[model samples]
Target: MASDLSPASRRRMQLALLLTPVSLFFAVFFLGPLAIMIATSFLAPGLYGGVEWVFYPHNYGRILGFADPAFEDFDPVYISIFLRSLKIAAFTVIATLLVCYPAAFCIARLSERSKNFCLFLITLPFFASLIVRLFIWVLILRQTGIVNEMLLATGVIDRPLELIYTDGAIVLGMVYIFIPFMFMPVYASVEKLDWTLVRASLDLGAGPIRTFLRIILPLTSPGIAGGAIIVFIPALGNFVVPAVLGGAKVMMLGNLIEQQFLSARNWPFGSALAMMVMSVMLVMLFVYVIATGRRGADVTN
Candidate 1:
């Protein structure tokens, strides 16, 4: 009496129902702003701050070192900033991975109560405002800051080191802030790990390092990749950390975009810069997806 739908039809109906809210949410929130931003990138900047409805590519050209208004000389300043941002972002990903991997393993190996406490401590910093946390680093890194004071007391140096407003400071801040992001995904993967595989490898002829390189790393790679993407995407476009710790000396793509919009009143150029960042992020995510997919295929085979 109640046999109106096949299994496939029922599954399709359930999926559609489940996806309706998420689809609508993305359409309104994510896609809506993204479409607006992409459209704005091609438009002209208004006389002052806003955008005008006219197509222009000069904004992008300016960023790429063309569209110079004086002497027709090639200006590599913006290009340098973009590349510097990429380098810093890559460094942050590597540093965060190095720091988080061991910490994640320790957390994974802990008792449930200890694991929760460790996780809580790791994430407790998030409760504070990011700006506040960055400012604390600023205090710690400034020439006359705690680090310099301690060194001076120990007679380690005659003068304070130039820590703030430097590339190193920016990288340090980025690594510290993004470590939690990197740790969480790796921890999730480690929590699901089959320890029996690890034991079997060790019971056989495999050393710890060899077993980890061949077995453990491959199994947990998806989480590592996911965490790296999470940390890197944000670090690539980070503004506040650089702006605060860098003293505006170190600049990233986000800082450049923020400058155009806020200082230069160049909305079109800012939009273009934002679009470029999004493009890079998309490319990285695409590569990650393909690699992960290939790994999954290999596993199945």
Candidate 2:
């Protein structure tokens, strides 16, 4: 019904129209903030607050364990913090995989309705705020919490167990928070698994362990990799679980970033910390891609 515009022109125009919103969104929300953060990282710390216009690489040096000129010795605190964050993140990934594999497998084997229900229950926590759910755990783990009261009533212990505000509780909170991320991906892979291979391996006199290690494991490797990456990245940067559960005793990379910005009033240093986190996240994302690509290649071979 329209004008003398050529078909090609109309198609190009339609394509541009479709892409406009997403392109604008990416430019405005993602790239703009990223550019600012990177630029901020290079700026010197302001005399009192924020950042000065002067270029400075010292912020990164500080995080990398170099001492400022005033100090005689190098400070390794930030380096240790980064290492601790990685360790916790790695452990959480392993733990999540261990817990999710069996649970995902069970769900995969269920009747369709039951599988749907189980998956729904697994994801039901999303309906509530994460902080609220974490606080619920706090209630159950505190000295006067449900667990302690139950143990007391049963005469299992005379005193309450120390459950909250510890590394163990922080780990528990992180695991609980991120388990669904691990489970959903693994469940998808398990649901799509070819059980014929498992049966065939068993028939060929390969034991359960051997069959799993050989055939079954390789097939679902992609899902496990995806889940692990998903869990690890967020866990690495997590501040909330450690804050609420571990209290002042625990701090992760996210907390470090938060502290620099909010408490220390060190914008340049905070920006540097943030950019490091973004870089680490990018590396993890690349690893996820490569690992999944190799798994796909192996499957093809």
Residue-level lDDT of model 1, residues 85-139, one tens digit each, is 9999999999889998988888898998999999999998767688888888999
lDDT of each: 0.89, 0.87
lDDT of predicted model 2: 0.87
Residue-level lDDT of model 2, residues 50-74, one tens digit each, is 7889888888888888846665368
lDDT of 1 at 44: 81
Worst 10 residues of 2 by lDDT: 66-75
Collision pairs in model 2: none
TM-score of each: 0.86, 0.92
Indicate the residue-level lDDT of 193 in model 1. 88
Model 1: how far residue 250 lies from native, Å: 1.2
Model 2 spans > 4 angstroms off: 69-72
